[model samples]
Target: MASIEKLPMLAAGYEKLTAELRALRDERPLIVDAIEEARAHGDLSENAEYHSAKERQGQVEAAIADLEDRVSRAQIIDPTTLSGDKIIFGATVTLLDDDDKPVRYQIVGPYEADAKAGKISYNSPLGRALIGKRVGDEMEVSVPAGERFYAVEKIEFI
Candidate 1:
């Protein structure tokens, strides 16, 4: 038997996925109604409404299945419950860039990653380098902008 891979995520991320799943499930009935109404318009061969509705149903079902899988494999983690000297998942880290500017980011799951919001996925290049690092530790990462260097300045659970 193949082992199931667990997806690590914060509680908030888990809740968000579940909420989205609920919304999609709720929309199922509406999609069904739309398909029925479209079918009543006759001639399925060239019916634009029917085709559109069917396409939407397919998209929604695919999304629902993907979300369901992610939710089912989710392993919710609370940052506040963690305490460590080295960086790890859920660790809010502050790094000093080559220019000495402090940049802060929280290592989170892929679904919760939002670079603009200072949340990075643990699997990200920078995030991966920062893992298991402590204060004053320097690391380099290659990004789309080019190679960059950073030094761990601080790590916090919250």
Candidate 2:
């Protein structure tokens, strides 16, 4: 038997997934209606509307299944409840680049990661390197752009 993989996420991330699942569920009825309306137009073989609706239905169902799986495995975590000197998931870390410029990032689950938003997945190269690091620790990570180095300046659970 294989063990189930758990997805760790913040409360907000879990809520976001559930909300999207609800929206997708709500869209199911509309998709069925669209299929019925397209079928009424006849000629299923060459009917563009029917084919398009069917493709959309497939995509939506696939998305719903993926979201459901992720939601089912979700382990909600609160950052504010965590406290430690070492970097860990849900830690908001501040690092100084080679130029001594400070960059802040919050370690989160893969689904909640948004680089532009300063949220990084715990599995990312940089995030992985930062894990278990304490203040003033230096680490290097290889990204698609190039190799980058950073020094841990601070870690907060907020």
Please list all clashing residue pairs in model 2, or write none if there are none: none
Worst 10 residues of 2 by lDDT: 139-148
lDDT per residue for candidate 2 within 37-84, as digits (tens), equals: 999998899999999999999999999999999999999999999998
Flag regions of model 1 displaced more than 4 Å: none
Candidate 2 lDDT at 116 equals 99
Model 1 clash pairs are none
